[model samples]
Target: APLGISNRDFLQQRKVIFDFPTKGVTYMHFKSIEHPEKPLVKGIVRAETIISGYIIEQIQDDPPITQLTVISQNDIKGLIPKYLVNLASGKAPKQWIGNLINGC
Candidate 1:
């Protein structure tokens, strides 16, 4: 008679584990959850551009995030990451200015 295998045994056999880095995913396009009527958000890649005289402000590139492109409708099960979703939703990002004089 053959013995039954446990969940752990199955996992071990499959070599599955929750050991992966989830940080520094800088570039990624996310779909919109707020407005279904609108199109999917496009992720923008930031680049340096010299304007006027000084380097300031960032702009979105034409190409969307490569990682996001792989994601299918089914992959986006629920509300996706806010940053990524912003592209499609046309949402504004949080802004904060520091006061050098006051040290804010």
Candidate 2:
């Protein structure tokens, strides 16, 4: 299996692991999750943002990429980097703060 664990095991181990923002909470300068290979766009989180909900969805049955979904305000579904996302807490890293502030 891609994930090394069987599907049944993966599902059994699955838990709400990340500190997901509440359905409507706005995250400032939210990065795009859809395209990892391409440059990321700095997105502003607003009340009107159309996030379907944060979820760790299974992309591949084998060697699964730890991808998370981020629905845009325009209702477009995008993928987020699982590594950057703090599964333990929803806190942004210090480096991300600088990037967000400087628009780096």
Candidate 3:
């Protein structure tokens, strides 16, 4: 039910939402290295197609590293814009951060 209308898939007719209860656990939030700006995309982690799923972890803000967990992986193909994904994957443009804060 998290699906909604957006410019990304408005004409493609691709649903941003996937079926619920991804994997054995339900994802409350997700942080993508491929879409850092799109932080905490709320949804369920699918049971299948895990390799491309999200990795979950709790870390201290001070030092940043902590216990990392692969909470769930999702098929967020069209959900996250490719530009944001590129940013998340480190292939980001020079103004990625600026663009993120300023909104794409």
Candidate 4:
């Protein structure tokens, strides 16, 4: 979910690889779960993320070389316009990646 967008409950797990290599995983799975606290929304939109850990590449660049693949989807059921939802869905990946990069 986007920052400061809504209150959501989710579970995320990371698998640590022993003797890490140039290519390794930092997370395993993630899924939305039943909210235990009071949510700040009228309705709930279940979401989950499927990630393919990055692989370090033998390339030199100003930023860095790493491949991170993510399969994320949102099941927004409401009176929102289809086009608007589609547009937001398309930008989700970029937003996630950008957040990750900026964090590092």
Q: Whole-model Cα lDDT per candidate? A: 0.26, 0.34, 0.36, 0.52
Over the stretch 1-104, how does candidate 2's per-residue lDDT look in tens digits?
12322221100111243333544333332332433344333452212223333344444657865444443332222343454333412442344345645993
Model 4 scores worst on lDDT over the 10 consecutive residues at 49-58
Which of candidates 2 and 4 reaches a greater lDDT?
A: 4
Q: Note the residue pairs that clash in candidate 2.
A: 2-62, 2-63, 3-63, 33-79, 34-79, 50-73
**Among these predicted structures, which one has the highest TM-score?**
4
* lDDT measured at residue 15 in model 2 versus the true structure, 0 to 100: 25
In angstroms, the error of model 4 at 102 is 1.1
TM-score against native, each model: 0.14, 0.19, 0.19, 0.53
Residue 37, model 1, lDDT = 52
Backbone-clash count (model 3): 6
Question: Residue 25 in candidate 3 has what lDDT?
Answer: 29
Stretches off by above 4 angstroms in model 2 are: 1-52, 74-104
lDDT of 4 by residue, 1-104 (tens): 44434434334444545324544434334444445564435545444434433333335466766555565554554355677678887886788789978999
Of 3 and 4, the candidate ahead on TM-score is 4
lDDT of 3 by residue, 8-103 (tens): 211111122232344332233423233344443344332223333223344455776544233333344545566665554553223444564499
Q: TM-score-based ranking, best first?
A: 4, 2, 3, 1
